[model samples]
Target: MENANRGYERLFGDDGLTVGATFPLTSARTTRPNVGRELALTERLEALGFDGLWARDVPTDWPKFDDTGQTFDPWTWLSRVAARTDDVALGTASVVLTLRHPLHVAKQAASLDHLSEGRLVLGVASGDRPPEYEAFGVAEDERGAAFRESVEVLRAAWRDAHPEVETRWGTLDGTLDVVPKPTAGDLPLLVTGNSRQSREWIAAHGDGWLFYHLPEDALRSYLDDWNERTAAPFVTTCTVDLAGDPEADPEHVNQGFRAGAAWFRDYFRELDAWGVDHVIVGVRGDDRERAYERVAERVLDRL
Candidate 1:
């Protein structure tokens, strides 16, 4: 396994606009997955020169959310990926921070960072899973505060040898400690969707941002406003179902688009011009292998 903190450099280099692929290679709705195939594709993605490999955290099955991200435990799955790949950044697209204890989150995140040789970018959120609140016994109103506390605790836990923090997740006295600190001694805590916190709060506390796909015009305006407020990198996601015809124009899909590789290059170029730092794409096709084929010569080769 590699043993260096290159995750940050790999994602945010002097050059701009890196690309990554999201988990669940196939859009299979069921919770079960063909782990062997997913791993194979992950290795392929790395070999193909994608900058990162993003995994999702879905602690429980919540159909309303519409997607079962990878259908595997984020920690275990990412650890396996880290061991398999040589140097692709390992990330959690958005871990529901409020639902789990911050200590446990810190421990797992730190461990993954080490195993990946400091290639962990933790994307976190207060959680949008409504039923999970009741299941985890976390009150809805308390989630925002809980989210803030979790971020603070995670940062402290990874850095301070014996951090003293008190929150709804429980108190961490200076006497106690969590082991296996991050390989870099820090994890880029990128907050997703504000988590019901103010933009000011997000800018102040978060190391970066992970937002949903927005209209190009709105995105430009939003980025300008955000840039004026903070220097954080603006990150987003796209679901791509590349058309067989490389010259086809883009048509709207859910939070993304269905287009040809030619359109994809221009689309991504537009994002780069608009100041987008990185994009995590969820490939959509007839199957996982077909999706890779569509992206290979058509997309990656051109880019």
Candidate 2:
């Protein structure tokens, strides 16, 4: 696949590793964060040496799930981030394709890609939230198929003029076309999670893979499995709570780690050596700016 998008280039490459950050960049245990403050922090992303910024698509607040995923619409929030920064790739950790119309996603993603000058890399997924399925009138069991359809639609809508497509979301005849095609002609679609699809299916379809954090041994195994299927890039999410002590040993936290800079440096190196292309860092600290600086100085620069 042709990766002409700047964001795709910034995030994925050969024999290299880069780091990005996710929203709710601070340790605010709330559904929402201060938008102005967050925007200000975004302006400094590239200056801080971060390569990308990620947003999550949380259609609604599911208290049981307990994560608001930045508590803003992913498209709107990313536009704001795009306006404030230059160069850093803007991404969705994974948009819930099952809940959205693929044509709409295609238009919005293409528009953002242009507005940001080809700095959009969409990570798409079949949603996992059960209640959201009911709310959106989407069948939970059929999300896998819907996800595949959405991916197909998005690619067609972007690459072809007035492309013909037939799916559960209705048909797009060769009459009207979605305008403002991605600057790269096609955007990079990184499949998130299994998305209720077979590993072979994901490998064949996705331009890349967005996976969650795993233990070193497990990650190496997963990478090996992925390499056997395809040579596409692999990205993972890592949530870290940086300690005050530089040499502090890592203590596993929820889905991530509470560790110091020293531990993270070693961990990132291992990931790089394992052929992991990028990591979307979710900082779990009160002072996100300080934590970002620490990682930049102690981990990223050294790498």
Candidate 3:
């Protein structure tokens, strides 16, 4: 695959840095179902000048995780969003690669990439939910291995013709060649968190990194560490509760920064300064329309 044809390079840049937000399609369920609001919201986001819309992959409910974000199938939601918007990029905050077959992921992602005209950014991680892993008949400790294997398989399937893949999970002996190759030749793949993999491997293989909210200093340190090891860019996702008042005080969510428009603007500037290439803002606990409007009016213009 040509380097210029990589989705990450096109969506972000050579630096791999862009600013984006998580759409409230799933979280703001009171208004309508995801499919109903997807197109309009996507168009709104693109019109508002946002770069991308990130979706989450939640196969099952986990009350203990206290995950307030909507649990939707990332691929399906992205496909719907892709059909709706013409420019804004589509992504998964992460799809738990350990639980699913890599070939399945490669095929679906390639199809989505082609359908979306090469606007797919894939974030993958080793699943942490013990119960979910157990249900899938995969041991907890095996997640790391599974994650590595999945990455290898997906890359091979996408780049190699009739590639042979073998691992404990499964094996493929040149019997299949996934169809609908990515429009960009390769889909951008970001590694979310450490996922039990070493920084060296992640830096070497991943196109980017997906991380959560951390203190400025901590985030800077992490970015420095990642940069030291690899030139690949980094991507971070955060839950944001945009306040109506431009001067509203900042609050906190699990991995979000709760602040008014003014603060949000400054925060993004800081992130940009810190060398964060792209930020996927997860919208939670806000008046959906008003919050998005505020961001569009105040923050998007400035970014």
Candidate 4:
């Protein structure tokens, strides 16, 4: 963990599971906002003892995707979040690296990390939305290579004063530099999913892995595979819509479960047992406020 960020260490500590929040902190999936409410919720989440505050990168309003992802440019959004919060780890649940230039990403990520006082956790991925790829004029088929190249550039820019990297994206010939290095000197790069790269490649390049939700057995199997590949941390997103009953059993809901606090606590314990280092819990429901309170009371407090 050389050059590790303190906030990151708080969020994903050495040997235990931690929980974090994803914005806009409500169940809404569209592009409109109660910006003030969201910010207030962020402060409240940190006070409630959440380890991290995560933002997503969705460059456009792709109708098919449905999820608008907090509907803000991540750099601006995260810098703003950084100012308003004191202790929570600031993260991109992931920024799509394929659509963006590496130099721009490096500069912006470093800036945010500095602004947040080393709280930034850079979650990155290749472009996933087909329409987004078309709009960026990048070939979807070439994204795998593009993603790999971008990772190299981001790392080089942060780790070296004048990074000279030669890739199809372009060369950083050491003539110029991406300034404002992260407080840790180099920020952690948590690769989101395979990103069209092999598991081995992720193991070699990424500091950690952020995966989508899968069943317990499936996630365990995947973690088993990752254990063979590398010793990096394993992270996953869980969209929770907590039930009213403490003893309610789990029912399926959009890559997560609709379970009561009793079941939810037990389920998280199960995930922890399965080597899931952290979970990005996206609570979804009409009564998100109630869910939030209940989460801290019955679920998080007990955990």
Best by lDDT: 2
Q: Kindly list the per-residue Cα lDDT of model 2 for residues 69-160, writing each as its tens digit.
A: 88889999999899898899999988999999998999999999999989999999998889999999998989999999999999899999
Q: Whole-model Cα lDDT per candidate? A: 0.83, 0.88, 0.76, 0.86
**lDDT tens digits by residue: candidate 3, 67-148:** 5344457787788778887777777878899888888899999988888877888888887677899888878887888899
Task: Indicate the residue-level lDDT of 281 in model 3.
Answer: 70
Question: What clash count goes with each model?
Answer: 0, 0, 3, 0
Cα RMSD of predicted structure 4: 1.2
After superposition, the stretches of candidate 3 with alpha carbons farther than 4 Å from their true spots are 1-7, 14-17, 26-34, 284-286
TM-score of each: 0.94, 0.97, 0.90, 0.97
Write out the backbone clash pairs for model 3. 17-277, 18-277, 22-281
- The residue pairs in collision within model 2 are none
Clashing pairs in 1: none
lDDT at residue 283 of model 2 (Cα atoms): 73
lDDT of 4 by residue, 95-192 (tens): 99999998899889888888888899989999678988889999999999999999889889988988899997898889988898888889888899
Residue 35 displacement (Å), model 2: 1.3
Question: Which candidate would rank higher by TM-score, 2 or 3?
Answer: 2
Q: Give the winner by lDDT: 2 or 4.
A: 2
